[model samples]
Target: MTFAEITTKRGDASDGMATGPLGRAHVRADGPAKITGRATYALEHAVADALHCVIVQSTIGAGRVVSIDKSDAEASPGVHLVLDAGNSLPLVPKADFFGNLPPGDTFVPFATEIRHNGELVAAVVADTVEQARAAADRLHITYEEAPVVATFADPRAGDGNPVEAMSKTWGEAEQALAEAPVSIEVRYETPREYNVPIEPHGLIAHWEADDRLTIHEPSQWIDGMANQFATWFGIPFENVRVVSPYIGGGFGSKGQALPHSAVAATAARMLGRPVKLAVTRPQTFTAHGGRPATWQTLKIGASEDGRIVAIDHRGANETAAAANFVETLGVVTSMMYAVPNFRSRQTIVPVNTVVPGAFRAPGKNPSAFALESAMDELAIALGMDPVELRRRNEPDVDPENGKPWSSRRLLACYDAGAAAFGWSKRNPEPRSMRNGRQLVGWGMAVGTHPVYSSPGEAMVRVLANGRVEVLSSAIDMGTGTYTILAQTAADALGVPVERVEVKLGDSRLPRAPVAGGSQLANLMVGAVHKTALAAREDLIALGLSDPNSPLQNQANTLIIEDGMIGPPRGPAIPLGDLLTATGRDALEVTRDTLPEKERTAEERLSMFTSLAGMERGPGIPKSRHSFCAHFVEVLVDEDFGTVRVSRVVSAVDAGRLYNPKLADSQFKGGIIMGIGMALLEEGITDPRNGRILNANLADYLIATNADIPAIETISVGEPDYDATPLGGKAVGEVAIVGMAAAIANAVHHAAGKRIRDLPITMEKLL
Candidate 1:
């Protein structure tokens, strides 16, 4: 069904949800508080008797900590204590990039050795944040520097034991390349970029006299932090109460309990005082996981008419020697499209850099650029329409799934996006459309986010007064998760939106998964839907059996509409009637949706994972994720070496869209970020010094408000219901998939030059 042609609308006035008689709810929950700026984010927290904990970072990329003299800083006013890594005992170790979970010894931050340029070398606590910052600058450090492998220029030279660092194998790629009808071989590089979430990283720890530590920080996952802190700090999980009531944003960096967060808490526990540490903007790019620098080589062999035969995708990402974190980009190259004779490989090249972590689409953000750009070029080479080319190769089943898609809407996406963007009217000639001095171009792309689910627990409480309160640990990251969850609760309880209150983002609340990977909705809403249903059923039974209320013996069927639980047969009666008759304030119910993996295991080991989601610690059935079709329109001023993304139309089919407005935001954000990855954003690290330079918002360019043209988002929502109870999929991460390439293809259409390297920098065009 078409996205905008609202057919089934079932919402109420209390929440501005649903359509027609009733549809989805309105933007409830945090809308007014957020728009008015009265809400408190994690960074704005105030803790009594808290000392400012300032982090001192490394100056060099790779080196041994030769000497650390802190006498000068220790003597400063307001200075309470200083902590190097040496002070943090029970050094919790984790798995390196290649999966060889390693252990540490004497990691005395500037005590013995330095690893990456931004590595946390030391921390200081003082009366004020400024004082801590000032005293931290007084630290004297001397290091024994070593040669830094900062790039993927030489794979083997940069990565030790290439065999184990990057596992790779495939068919006879060399032989196929020789006999191809038409072959395109290109190397694409996407520079490391920072996720400049509006809220800077900060932590405030409150260590109670009772040995229980309460931390107020900005994290997407409080339970995950509870677990991480407990594991790393060598403390009982119960003692660590992570409270992140609100967060500005977490692209992907806030998924885990950050290293500095751990260090700050450990220092507070050891020093016997509360500690507050906040990273500077420059420090943010270094300490937190930045998008790793990528160097990819994609080889596509196609027939004379532009049909791809063999696809070989090989790439390596620059990561930290201290922490090996690899965001594999070759997955799409292997799975996307219908090229079966394909193989992929990923190599993690250890560079003198901070550990890289998940950032939005991960590899698909870049790989889609590479693969889609090639497909665009292939279309141009064969004089065929790019949309038709993609349509020709659209696979019926998840080649990886070995099963048909519950429903695939790539064709629908292509058609819908094309119609919206006016793809049919564009001229196929270079610099064909012109308005005055501007050489106008239009571009479109396909967006596809995979399915991601983590374990989550939700508590649905029907108050004694017939009110609904959903206690959840999930955080809303610029997405309308709060409203959507409330909708599910309302729909399930058969109550009005006013009666349902969703209390989320608190550790005290039941554990919910981190709000990322487009998994927040999938993980949190199902349990709520089920729980609400149960509550409604229970209330109905109570009314039937009690016979003390108007709802009893009415000889009518009643469904919860708005907040009334009256009869379909009699005069409408609000659910509040039961509470009044019973002389109660509210009723409550709570249930937990186990991670799909474990819950599915409880069922027969069917071909698909259980409709329920799963938590970490392995054994989850990693199914073949969802897919989409992207088309972009770009206007390239060829002579000026400049491009403007005039329009972007993205079509995605991410299972069932519980709320269209919410889903549209995901698609828009994805395409917009993709445009940045293609044209503007990149984190530049110095090759000579192994230091990341563009570490702040000013130097690193993301899409400004003006940079984004009209983004037309189309969703083939829930055409596929293979692995999800709601017939849903992960839509956030893959929304920008193939976004850049669509622009690149449009660039070719307007400028007739294929600029392989990023940004299509002016120099390259000139």
Candidate 2:
């Protein structure tokens, strides 16, 4: 099974047969509308008589509010109401993190107790956004500040608790490390990062009546948001509606409902009017979670022949004092490679900051940095080619649970990427490759992310006019969800791509999993595929039973293609004509894909405990993961010590690609984000006051067009049918997993400088 084989099975219109779109490079359906500014985002929706709301944040990091004087704000012009602890809707306590029980204190916004700086304290609703901002500024508040433990480095920071179920030891790691002939130990640090999507978090909450709440917001998890609001307000779940047709970008930031959304909903209900709140650029840093700061120390031992004998990874990540969200630093460590003995310990260090949440690869990003960099170091110790070292340690079964892999084509990716990037031309010696006062270096590393799928439901309708519509609560988030889903329905229904329509990001539609973890593609596509097949079968049955139909009782030889149904090789009849003959306007079917339904409640809870994938155990006989290899070239200036990634070749094995064009873009996007993590992006927190110094885009750096290099992406491997019915795995996040390490290895090769800390800035090189 290879990419070539996958391409052959892709649907073909040439032979007059209908098949699902599996490996096509179709353009995004939403691109034209988005580029022309005709697409409506969450904040772009219009509502009559909607008041604007602005939030006031706490100045102190940890404290108790002494007093709040809202008199001036109440008297301000156009101020409809000022909501604070003194007067706000009381919310019932619900299980944290979408009802997945965890050991942590649950909290809501508009509290008098300050947990961290920028905590939501009050909100002002007025006739306009400017008036709301003015009133928010006029509110006088005083706080009795307490001492703050800002980060993992703070002396007051606790030793932290071991992450439950995440920390485990297999075999005798210490004994194996001691007996191994070769070994290396290294510590790597990654700084706090924020998900500053193009469109900041915003919401417009409206109460149509006392019991009904409607929110037009950008949400990655529509059903979760509706359920959360329903739980908070003690209303029926059906009464809460979440409508998010389009989003600017999410990158995991919009997966969960933050406190600001709650404040807006509260204000809207209190004022008896609609309230719109757009989180400012700076507030987005603390309003929702991002990638947490991590400290990882890895000890790897190998034989002289480069076979990994032992690996011990111990790490800590910063979480909020008010929440329990630990970065699973051992996510990729336990199963990435073939190590006979493995040990991992993950600790959660509570800091005076916002609770960290998902950011793209989340746990795997930082974990891969440490483990992959350590592998590079081990390769240096063994005097072996990095690619060869990885090939030698490739596992036959999952090292964590001894399960066979559904699909493991990582070596193929390495081969493809290395050949494309001209790896054989490289000189492995550090600082040996030079060109005109600049040093060139080539480096490569393994990339991986787990495959996850939750229950998803979708509705497919084939109209009498020969058009198809697929509806689901899943969102695009600029990931081509609409395009791929439409393609899936069109392929399944034997129709042209142009005749399929996709409607998503609304709770009123069929339910879907959250758009994070790269799981929506598998779940939603499978649901659409099933429902479309059922609809086609229903239509064919109608044609057989209809007395006026041209082809009755030809079930075995019937074929549906190009919106026409007939016996193979003859007498094709239009689908619209059959529907008219049957006295039916359309055929519709709704279906769901529930892969995890057999798991117990406890097992289900463990799946989303920290946004990691399902645990490998006896019930699951196969370990599923998407694999890639990144070959990076970096240039180092002789005088200034600035490093730039000149080019990248990322070869990915994500089962079967539904849309190669979109997959190509997703690969490049993740690589560019990896560049930011390696050389540019860092959230500078003022430890003294627990304030994020670089909160705005001007201060918080990201990879722009000027920083990007030429990126080449190659798709590899066959469809992993064992993992999912669609034969596709997670695609987006794995590209960023090993990127930072590859760039760091390139830096060391170019300048002979090893900087363990993230954002390998010029000062460290100099």
Write the residue-wise lDDT of candidate 1 on 1-766 in tens digits. 0011122233443213233211252543565676678778776776678888888888887777777788999999899887775555545653322343445642222324666777788888899988888898898988888877666664444543232423434556667767888888888877787888888888888778544778888887776676666656556666778887677878888877666886778778777888888888888987777788887888888787767778878877777676567766766666567765666677777777777887887766777777777777677777778788887888766554345555667787778878877888988777787866666665544555566665566777666555678878777777766777776786677665555677777777776666766777876777677777777877777666565776777754556666776667566666767867866576666666653434443242211112224332134343436566666667666568778887776777776677676677777887788778778887887876678778888888888888888877666555344556666677667777777777777777767677766766656766
- Model 2 residue 423 distance off true place after TM-score fit, in angstroms: 1.0
Q: Determine which window of 10 residues in candidate 1 has minimal summed lDDT.
A: 1-10
The C-alpha lDDT values of all candidates are: 0.69, 0.84
Best by lDDT: 2
Error of 1 at 448 (Å): 2.0
TM-score of each: 0.90, 0.95
Backbone clash pairs for candidate 2 read none
lDDT of 1: 0.69
